[model samples]
Target: MSTIIYPAPIFGPVHSRRLGVSLGINLLPGDGKFCTFDCIYCECGYNKDFRPKQKVQTREAVREALEKRLAEMKENGPFPDVLTFAGNGEPTANPYFPEIIEDTLALRDKYFPNAKVSVLSNATLIHNPKVFAALNKVDNNILKLDTVDMDYIRTVDRPTGHYEVENIIEGLKAFKGNLIIQTIFMKGTTEDGKDVDNTSDKYVLPWLEVVKQINPRQVMIYTIDRETPDQKLKKATKEELDRIARLVEEAGIKASASY
Candidate 1:
């Protein structure tokens, strides 16, 4: 299987289609992919494909690297608009996640006070109190919620453990509008030839209702940008995403779509 692993702990002032000019903080190992979900569309590929050469980054290591990058950017180079937590896999999987967030916030305040701190989480760990609290403290707590149907979740996003759709929805609702709900829209055929299409209303309406329930600050809807692990998958059309965005707006929730 073709895959991409982020080979560094601190890299990127890349232009994020959603989060603007962002400096990424990768808390996972530089060599391996560690995540709670093995989603079919994950650009980093499935968790099973990973083989760790480096241990998961520790809090101090992340702090040192981030501070070095920030000081350099602050002193001699361009500044970032946001400090994002995203890399090879789910950043929350890092044991030192909460502390890393603390360090990232302090560095952002010291070097670029105006820069927003964002975390892209899968919502599986939202029930963890420390993770929940840290997410609330960030500027953008982007949580993933692809479909309300459990079967679709299993066939598509593929949560790794004792994941239940109803339970995760309740957990996501705990954020109570303090979060940004990010949904990736796509279509593909399962190994058994079962069709999976989350962009359709049969899926989107129930999901939008859950969005109304969670009542997040905004909903970011986007389609596949990079090559997915599953070659059979296709990105949602811009026209389709636009229609979905309008539905979100009509529900009184702020929405943006990146096609």
Candidate 2:
């Protein structure tokens, strides 16, 4: 199945189960995707044939667009529940992420004071002081951590050369309880037909260790809800997601399954 691609900075005031009515902010260019990790389950599709060159909207342009949208929404009355930083690729990959967040926050305060500022990052940039500071400014800092086992993480997330599992975990540990961890569960037959199931105890155990170390405020567990580039992948059943949530809860962390 072909993935739905929205080529713009502001795509929708779409309904989000976790974030309510979210107004999306796409920092990456509309014509291409730019992210450090090329995950198998990414809704934007795999980054195999794409380059990671950045061509993000300028801070002035994003601010202007957001202000105009907010003003229009205000004139129409009610506003979206959240102004979310999410799009074709990792939002934090934009060099001006911190400035963007600051500008967004200013707009949020001026136009849609009731709405929250949310950022969805892959966690690769968490180690950067600027990125961390920017994330700290947002209301919802949703970071991704699909797995902890190095081999599986490498296969699943396909992170860039600079991103190591240990470094990510180390960065996350500094987050304390200010972070929300997002994990997507799935089962699939690899290109070679080998079954890939991260739900198994072998994978979950090591993953849990990292979760414990990070101690995030909440863990949002969900399965495939949209079309992915890889058709061989199978979505984890609701029952499977619930079981995994239970494991996370038992570890003294809050878990919500959106399967």
Candidate 3:
């Protein structure tokens, strides 16, 4: 199946289920994927399948492109609800990410002060001091934490480099309720017949414990919405998602489920 590949620097003002009318800021190359994790459910497919031919857009270029887009939007009819840092890869992976966030905030203030700046990160680079600081600056510092199980993460999320869930949790706690926890819950079997379901109490309960420890401002629990590279993977049911959300609410934290 064909996968979604976004343009470089900037792409959409597409309607987002969670963020409303959104403008995307793609810091990675437009041609392919450059993420730290090779998730089976990623709409962008695997990293090796789509190696980027072009270099990551420079901070200056991103600023210029965003300014142009915001300018057009300001003159045109539909104003953006949020300026989102998302695309084919991890936005924080860009070398100039911190600088770009600073630029984005300045431009947002200039063009649409009402529009929120959001970043969708895998949470791998949150350990980096610069990335951590930059994320704190954004309106929505959305970080992914699928499960606490390391085997599941390695088999499913497939981190490219060194990744310790304990280390990540420590970094997340540093945010101290300023961040949002985004988790993707899905159920299905992989090509090799291993079960990929993570919506069970085993995963959910453990993940919830971590979320409580991190104590994020909110939790976004979502399922597969688009076609994945691994066709064997399936969407987590609405019932399962809602059940998990209810559990989060019971813990006195806000939760939103997107089925």
Candidate 4:
């Protein structure tokens, strides 16, 4: 079984392949994983493996913790390049996400005005008007979109309930030019030995069409960088990622591949 990745709420000015020098802000409860999607590639492990007794952090607590970390980083030098909302689970699931984003913005302004504020969301809660509004205020409103195929999504992302791929794609489109779409391209099988691959043109073409519709500022193409819930899964090579990125570029969208 894969271990829990992030057990703390506020952790590290860690080096990120996508967002440089990131300070993670986990909006979920400190002791467990809670998310709308149970993706096979999730580095934090399968959702069923996590259930914590701790409660979600209050807005005040988040504010206080962020302020303390920012102050410490400022005094010590090497201020973070980005304050990212990402960890064990969904940030927006906290119910106070709008208010948290507001606090983070203010704190970012106070500490590192030039640094970017990003959210590494699964894009599950964007239907909420408050969440949508708050996401717009960030420097990088990164949203996941592995493939446009619903079957592929169901196999990998496994969004809870009757959640549809079209719904997520449309919601991301509503972001207009404010969105940064992130894709994790890979080919392999699930733990059950089920074949699941999205690295082919069959998946990439339609996915690019959705990207064109969304017309985001940037498209982040990456592969599994750490161990995932599905051991049978294989990571996409940097070259394959670049090839897919070239297609996005051809469609007049900016892109980057992180292997």
**Best TM-score goes to which candidate?**
3
- Give the Å error, residue 121, model 4: 0.8
lDDT for model 3 comes to 0.94
Q: Per-residue CA lDDT of candidate 3, range 1-259, in tens?
A: 8799999889888999899999999999999999999999999999999999999989889988899999999999489999999999899999999999999999999999999999999999998999999999999999999999999999899999999999999999999999999999998988888899998988889999999999999999999999998889999989999999999999999999998
By summed lDDT, which 10 consecutive residues of candidate 4 come out lowest?
1-10
Show the lowest summed lDDT stretch of 10 residues, model 1.
188-197
Ranking by lDDT: 3, 1, 4, 2
Order the candidates by TM-score, highest first — what do you get?
3, 4, 1, 2
Q: What is the C-alpha RMSD of each candidate to the true structure, in Å?
A: 1.2, 1.7, 0.6, 1.1
> Which is the leading candidate under lDDT?
3
- Where is model 1 more than 4 Å wrong at Cα? none
Clashing pairs in 3: none
Which whole-number lDDT from 0 to 100 does residue 85 have in model 2?
A: 94
Clashing pairs in 4: none
Candidates 2 and 4 compared by TM-score, better number: 4
